[model samples]
Target: MEQNTAAVIRLESVHKTYHLGEVQVHALRGVTLQIRSGEFVAIMGASGSGKSTLMNILGCLDRPTKGHYWLDDADISHMSKNELARIRNRKLGFVFQQFNLLSRTSALENVELPTIYAGIPPAERHKRAREALERVGLGDRAEHHPSQLSGGQQQRVAIARALVNHPQIVLADEPTGNLDSRTSVEIMDILQRLNEEEGLTVVIVTHEPDIARYAMRAIEFRDGKIRRDQEIEERQIAREVLPTLPSLEDADAEEAEEESKVAPGESPAKAPA
Candidate 1:
C-alpha cells in the first residue's frame, strides 16, 4: 500500500493538567507533534513520562487543558463528550494491555460490539465481524469465548474488534504486555502487516525498547515533554524474526523435559541441583 504523507494527527502546544485538591499535576507540557497518515509510531516513556496522557488525548477520551489538536484535518481540541464519542467510533480504534473481551461473549459477538455503536445494521455488522475475525486468523473460533482461548488468541480477538470499524488509526497501549516473548512477536507481526499492507496508521505506547524497535519512528517522553523523536535505524521486521524464535510446541517439549528431571515427590523448582 502506498503511504500517505498528509498529517493525520497534529498537536500544538498541548498541555494537560489535573487538579487534585489544591495541587496541580501537569501531565503534559507544551508538546507539539504531528503523525502522518499510514505511519507507524511508538511512544516510549517511564511511569510519569506523559505518554499515556498523550495517548488519551489522541484517542479523544479526554480534552486537553490547553492547546490545539487537529485530527484528520478537524480541530477537535474542545469537542463535546458526545462529539468525541462519535469521532472515536468513526475514526479511531483502541487496543489495550488487557484483552478486554467479555468473558461470556463469543469472539464474534465481541468483535461486533463497536459496529453496534456505529449504528451498523445487524446483517452487515455480523458480516463485518466475521471478516474481522478472519483477518486475525480466528475465523474458526468465532463461537469461542475468551476463556476458551489463550492469552495471545484473546488479544487477537481484541485486534479484530478494533478493526471491525475500519478505523483510520489504531491506538494500542502495551499491546504485547500480557503475552509471552514469542506471542509478542506474533502480535507485532499483525500490527506490521496492518501498517504495511493495509495502510492503517498505527500508534502504540510501550516501555520496552525491543518493542519500540519494530516501529518506524520512536518518540520518547520525559517530564511531560518529548525527549527524543527520531526514525528507527535498522528497524526489526517481526515476520522475519518469528522464524528464529522457538515455537509453542518446542516450548512445551522443553517444559516437559524439565518436569521429567524432578523426583516423583518433588516439584520442578525443588529438584536436585
Candidate 2:
C-alpha cells in the first residue's frame, strides 16, 4: 500500500476514567496513537486493558474522560451524542462479535438500515444494499432471514450491513469469535480480499493470536497503553505444503522446521496481534 500518511483516527494524550463512588477506575491512561487511512489494524488487550474502552471512544459511542480525539474532520471527544450518531451512521461501519441482525428481517433489509437512517429513498437504498450483499457474495440470499442462514452466512450478512454504508473504515470486535476453525478462515479470506481489492481500513480487536496474523500490523495494549506493535507478515505461499521442508537461511533450522510443521488448524489470524 502507498504511504499516504493521512490519519483517519488520531488520539492525543487521551485518558478515560470512571468514578465508581469516588473509587476512580482508570480505563485508559493517556494513550496517544494514530491510525492511518487504508491501514488494517488490530488492537489486542486482556480484560481491563482498555481496548474496549478505546474502541468505544473510537466508535464515537462514548466520550473520553480526557484527551483529544479526531475522527476524520471532527474533534470527536466533545461531540454531542446526536452528532456522533450522525457520524457513526454515515461514516463508520461496525462488525460485532455476535451477528446482531434482526432475526426476522431479510438480509437486504438489514443491509438497508444505515441508509434508512441516512434518509435515502427506498429505491436507492435497496439497490445499494443489494450491491453490498453481492460484494460479500450473498446476493442470492438477499431475501433470507437471519434464522435461515448458516453461521458464516449470517456473519456475511452482518459484514454486508457494515459495508452497505460504504464506509471506508470498519471497526470489528471479535468478528469471528463465534465461528469454528474452518469457518473463521472463510471470514478472514473475505476480509483479506476486501483489504487487497478495496483498500478498506479495518480495525479489529481480538485475543486470539492467529487472527492477529491476518492484519498488516497488530497493536497490543496493556493497562490502557500500547505495549507493543508488531508487523505480522504473511509467509511466502508455496503451491502446496512442502512434503520435505527446505532449509531456511538466517533462521534456526530446528525452530523453522517446528514452525513449518504447524497444522492448518492452528491459526485463523487475529487483528495481526
Candidate No. with top TM-score: 1
TM-scores for every predicted model: 0.90, 0.84
Candidate 1 lDDT, tens digit per residue, 172-211?
9999887667777889999999999999999999999999
Candidate 1, superposed: residue stretches over 4 Å from native: 1-5, 249-273
Candidate 2: stretches off by over 4 Å: 1-5, 235-273
Clashes of 2: 9
Total clashing pairs for each candidate: 0, 9
Candidate 1 whole-model C-alpha lDDT, 0 to 1: 0.88
Query: TM-score for model 2?
Result: 0.84
How far off is model 2, as Cα RMSD? 9.2
Per-residue lDDT over 161-243 for candidate 2, one digit per residue giving the tens place of the 0 to 100 score? 98888887889888888765445566776777677689888898989877777788889999999998877777221222222
Predicted structure 1, TM vs. truth: 0.90
